[model samples]
Target: MKITLEKVHGSMNTFYMVDGEERDDYANLALQLCAKDQGVDGLLVILPSNSAHAKMRVFNRDGSEASMCGNGLRCVARYVCEKEGVDEAVIETMKADLAVRREETLMDGIETYSVQISPVSFQLKDLPMEYDNQTTLIQQAIPEISEEIMFSAVAVPNPHLIGIVPEEIQKSPEHQKKWAEKFNGQNNYFSDGVNVSYVTKVGQGIFVRTYERGVGFTNACGTAMTASALISCMSDMVPFGEVAVYNPGGMVKCTVNKSGDTFELLLTGNATRLSVHEFQWEEEQVDSEFTAFEILDEQRQYEKFIEEISVVVEQFAKRKE
Candidate 1:
């Protein structure tokens, strides 16, 4: 059947958003569409919702259904708001129906949207990580990961492990991958796998690099960044308010509103639509010619936005050095 798949990204964490009827073959569909050849970080299916403006179902490249995806949620926000002729809407996720709103352009010609990242938890039973009798891990050193670095686990609806590491460990992608593999693989530490992020406090903001569950390492992970920001707040590394979260892909702003033990985060970033593909999709395969009319302007504008942030990134790296 002929269908429209919009390629979208928030902070360069990409996904192919399909506004279609809800179906059961999402696992198989994600595995196929998210393959490396014609792939994205994940697949987003937008279905009509009785409880909210729209429903977002996210499937990672590994065909795992995630509880929430803030990046994907922003894309869905833009798509649904544009379709529904509204500036704000509540989109149903696997965990909750999140509030998303259209915002002023974040940069030159780059459309922006802000979505809520919420219902934070640090309880052990909430995460896939298997830790001892502790109810939560808040900046504790887990010897299995690294004796020196402290880790904090949070379920911002999707399980995440955040570590504020020193220069050496933060710069070491191999170091992050090494431990991420152990926990995501055959290890008792994380029986069901976890999204692991290594963060470094930078001169301008905080830098985060995430090794995601199901998707391995991504250019960015919105929920992971939000979790990391909340961790930064919990650790007093950064104040609990508007925090600039930078990843390898790009940067996003996370406003962490803290009231006692409760936390609410607003994630704002570029919801750039790369292109609209005119293609035919079958039940099992891409059965016909798929023409990609690339959006050069959005790509160019986003590149400029990336160029604008390179200074802060450079300053961060230099300060680390």
Candidate 2:
């Protein structure tokens, strides 16, 4: 069998997207393609959908399926848009049917996409967190991690535990990794585990580092950033507006709307189609290595886009200073 796949990234969180109609061994394929050596966060299998534009199925590097992925959605939207030549789409995930739009170009070569991450929830049952006597988990201290560190749990159909850390902690890469590791799955607080983000407020923006539940530390975790921004707004850490979210990979802008208990989030960022890999496989050979795959590089253009944005962000930071 011959398989063609697109490798794309949003805010540096990358995935290998393949059509579901082409193959049936997605779980094993995801594990193989998303290996650290392969340099991908996960694999997304795009399936046919009757309820929406298309169905998006996400698999972590560890081959665990996730309910939703904000970053992956942007890439999928871009894929569908470029493939179908449409400006808008509604992609179905396991959790919800998300609305996505191809926004104006952010850079000369990079296309920007905006995705609606909706149906936000803070209830314990939605996150399915093992907690008692609490309907909502908000800035609560889990003694298992520390006596001082407080966490806010929210699910944008994906479970996230966010901690507002000090500037110094967020600034130090070592500290960020340590804390991410501490609470990720090592801690006994969350039984099913959660994507953990350590966020720090910087000027009018915020910097985040996430230890994803199944993927561990990534360049960026879109839903984690959305969850971070939403919690920051709810906690009065950042006012409602265009929230610039800086992750280790790059930055993404999030527009948050909160009316009493209702919350809606819009995430806008680069949807970069880095390359395409074409390979030949046999159905019986699950772990077959593809030594003869073709690589089409779009990474150079993406790097240029990154460079343009980095300069802008630097100047903005300087102005703040």
Candidate 3:
């Protein structure tokens, strides 16, 4: 396992990318390094590109495969920008065109990298929730759950719910576990599956903690942020426009709008680099190093690039204000 590693920083978070199938094993080492230094916030393992196809899978330090990751994108973007010496770059994923840009960090000793997420769309049919075409008001309470949470399924590529809980509910271990269980199960709202997000507001910004489907509880989820923000706007919790989302891990800003018959979302967050290490493995006669590729046309990539840049400009403008 000849593995290469890169250190990239986003916001205040640092991540390590292991270019080999032994990502989980490497990620554990990275986590230990972060613990030793006491600065690393998250760990992501990007699987090596396959021979026949180029694709990557992500895993958090806890050895969980996240359905979607926003912060990790910035770390990868930094790798491309610094290694390739290009301010603007595109990372092809299995799902969407991740248009990335190098940005100045607001906080000292931190680097800011931004990546635009796939546009958001809400279709119960598309999400494949339990609800049918006619069911509009889903006020059903999940069985064996006490939070009285309501769920709305949205896809930025994963199923998620915008669980609205009262502010008075103290965030105890009991409370967190209670909601997490309900979100993971196939309740009356979503039979196929669902990721549960518990939301609250701190000042003008909205904060969330996600119980992801593929992965358990996590500090932040980019897709969940977009879905929760959209649900907030639709429920009039927050006005339509750009929304500031605070997750347990950190903050990610989301923008949403209506397009034709669906809602679109743009999720922005920071990423960072952790460490680089070589895998202790022998060389292959036919292989050089682990590689991955994504198939995206130039036109689509350029369009996404422009859109993401525009969002970065918006963030800069907000700073000016």
Candidate 4:
């Protein structure tokens, strides 16, 4: 089947804008191809399945799907509202319902987007942090780190570990690597690997570098930003309300209620359309390549098929002068 998709890039993440209807049919293909091509940090699909409600699918470059992504949804919202000339769009993902609206203008002189994620859930099981809720979590001194690192567990859609790293560790690669390993260890207190943010106070806003699970160090993580803003509020670093979070990729401003429980994330940045491509498949070739009604593990076969197709695409791109 021939598919149409839009390639959009946000601060540090990339995504594919596709029709919501074709999500289940083509999401895996898009994920594998884009990841292999290094075309994006993730995939955001607007499924045509429910045109009334657009679906956003985020897939890591490694082909693993994520619950939610802030940067990606903002970019996709901008594309749909501004480019497509729509006012409000509802983006449904694996996590929760996201309401995104278009901005009049962006700092980069382009359209901007904002998404309303679910209220930050800190309940131990909800956040899925390894710790039990019986024990209260407060700012504590880390073993090696000199300054205090405020670590908190919050989940908008997926889980995240928002930590305030000392400026010393923020600048030291060795320190960053050390904690990254610590954060990744199963003993780190998270059933599923948690996205850890090493944040520093940089003037008016906090600067962040995040080590995300499944996706490794990314420029900006939307959920991480929301979590950080909430953590900052809880720690009294920033006032309760809208706060600015600066990352290497761009800036995301988030608003939290007085209780620091509900969070509204505004990812103010550019979403540039890089390229668009068509998908074409040779049915006869595919059929001939495999035996009719051959027995094979569906999951394993599909994985191998994706890998092989990616190699072909890469080879073709390299062949271009």
Candidate 5:
């Protein structure tokens, strides 16, 4: 079987966007294609939807399916909107039907999209975290993670454990990988697994480093950044408005909103197309050698935008490279 896929990214969190018309073994495909050689974080499958413009299913490199992925949704939003010749779209995710639209211009020559991340919750039952039988964690010390640093748990429909760390911890990447390894493994914290992020405020903006649940340390995690921004607002780390959330990958704009008891957020960032590939698939195996490839030019523009805005974060991101 022949397969055509578009390589894309949001905040440099890359993915392979494929239509769900061909083979059905997405789990295997993600496991194989998201390897180091393929150089993608996950796979995004666009399936037919009756309730919205399209449906998005995310498969991590570890063959785990997430409830929702903010970055992948942005990429999917742009892809479907452009394919259907529309300016806006309502995409059905695992948890909610999200509204996404093209941004007029976020950066020069970059395609930006804004998407709704909703059904936010702070209850422990939602994240299902087990810690001393606590119901909610709000700027409280979690000794398991750090004896001094405090954490706040939030689920943007996908579980996240965020902590506002000090400058010392923020500069040390090894510390994050250490704790991420502990929580992602069989300890006693997140049983099912959770995305862990250590964030710090930097001149009205915040820099976030994430250890994603199934993807391990990543350049960015869309839901994690959204959760981090919301936690920052609730914890008074940053004002409740448009926050410049910087990650190792790039930066994104987040706005937190609340009405009555409900909370939702808007995540805006670049959805740059990287390249196109033609591959052969048979018996759940994706050919490593592509017959033909078309590398796109949007990445240079995206890198330029990142270079201009990410002086502080870029230094840290370079360590990942």
Candidate 6:
């Protein structure tokens, strides 16, 4: 059977969107297609929602499922909007029904989408973290990683551990990779594993690098960035406003708000449509071969956008020095 798919990315965290089909082995399909060297980061299966506009299911590269993915949500929103020829849409995720809107274009041909990342919670049960009687994990010391490495855990329905590292440590790619490896897995402190973000404060923005739970060392993790922004605001490091979150992939803006015990998060970034392809699927195989794959040639436009942002980042880094 021929299946249509779209390769999309938000803040460089890519996923393949496929129409929902009656398949019992979607996990295996996600594993085959989400390989870094072959496919993308994960798969988003579009489903029909009776109460909402559309429904989406998120699957990570390792055949594990996620409750929500902020980056993936943006791409799905764009997909739904374009397909329906609408300016806005509501996407029902596993965690919550999110509202997304088409914002001003980030670049020529590159559209920006903002998604509401909501119902924030810090309760251990929410993150389902085993932290020994702790209701919240905020800058707590975990001797496993380092007594010095303080982390804050939060769940926007997707669990994340945020670390505010020194600028020197953040600058070293090797350090970031090693730390991510140490804290993620069956034998790690987080038994269920968690998305880890190491962040550093820049002038008015923050630089973040993430090691996702199922997908490790991605160019960016949208929820991780939102978690970092929330932690920054909690620590009074950043004002309650749009926090510029710069990842290795590109930059996304997160607006955070706190009112007493309630918190709200909004993520604004590029929801890029990279390519479209049609593939053939067999019932017995784990992987599918594309019968007709076509690149949209938007790579050049995306590259230009990246180059322009790099110049700005370099200037910002230089000023900090």
Give me the runs in candidate 1 sitting further than 4 Å from their true place. Answer: 36-39, 286-296, 314-321
Better of 1 and 4 by lDDT: 1
Q: Give the per-residue lDDT digits (tens) of candidate 5, residues 1-321.
A: 678989999988889889875345888877867663456889999999989999999999898989999999999999999999999999999889999999966788999999999878888889878888889888898776678888888889999989888888888878888888887889787888889999999888898999998898888899999999998988888888799998888889999876777777999999989999886655544444456789989999887887787677864555243
Error of 2 at 211 (Å): 0.5
Model 2: what TM-score? Answer: 0.89
The per-model lDDT (C-alpha) reads: 0.84, 0.79, 0.56, 0.61, 0.86, 0.80
Query: Across residues 87-184, which tens digit of lDDT does each residue of candidate 3 receive?
Result: 87766564666677776653433455666667454666555565545333233444445537655656666666666666654253356556567645
In model 6, where do residues sit more than 4 Å from their true spots? 35-39, 311-321
Clash pairs detected, candidate 2: none
Q: Between the candidate structures 1 and 5, which one is better when assessed by lDDT?
A: 5
lDDT of 4 by residue, 165-207 (tens): 7666666546565666675675656666678777677655676
Which regions of candidate 2 fall more than 4 Å away from where they truly are? 22-24, 173-188, 283-287, 291-297, 308-321
Clashes (candidate 5): 0
Considering only N, C-alpha and C atoms within 3 Å, which residue pairs clash in candidate 4? 19-48, 20-46, 20-47, 20-48, 20-49, 21-47, 21-48, 21-49, 130-189
Tens digit of lDDT per residue, candidate 6, span 39-138?
Answer: 4788888888886778989899888989988888899988889888999989988878999999987788778899999768888778767876678889
lDDT string, candidate 2, 1-321, tens digits? 678888888978888888766455787778767542357889988999989989999999888889988888998998888788899999998988999999986666678899999778888778767665788889988665556667888888888888888865665557545655665555545656788888888778887788888887787888999999988887799998679887767788899997777888999988888777775545444545555445656657767766655643343222110
The global Cα lDDT (0 to 1) of model 4 is: 0.61
Candidate 1 residue 272 C-alpha distance from true site, Å = 0.4
Clashing pairs in 1: none
Best candidate (score: lDDT): 5
Q: Can you tell me which runs of candidate 4 are displaced by over 4 Å?
A: 20-27, 49-52, 82-84, 132-138, 141-147, 181-188, 259-266, 280-321
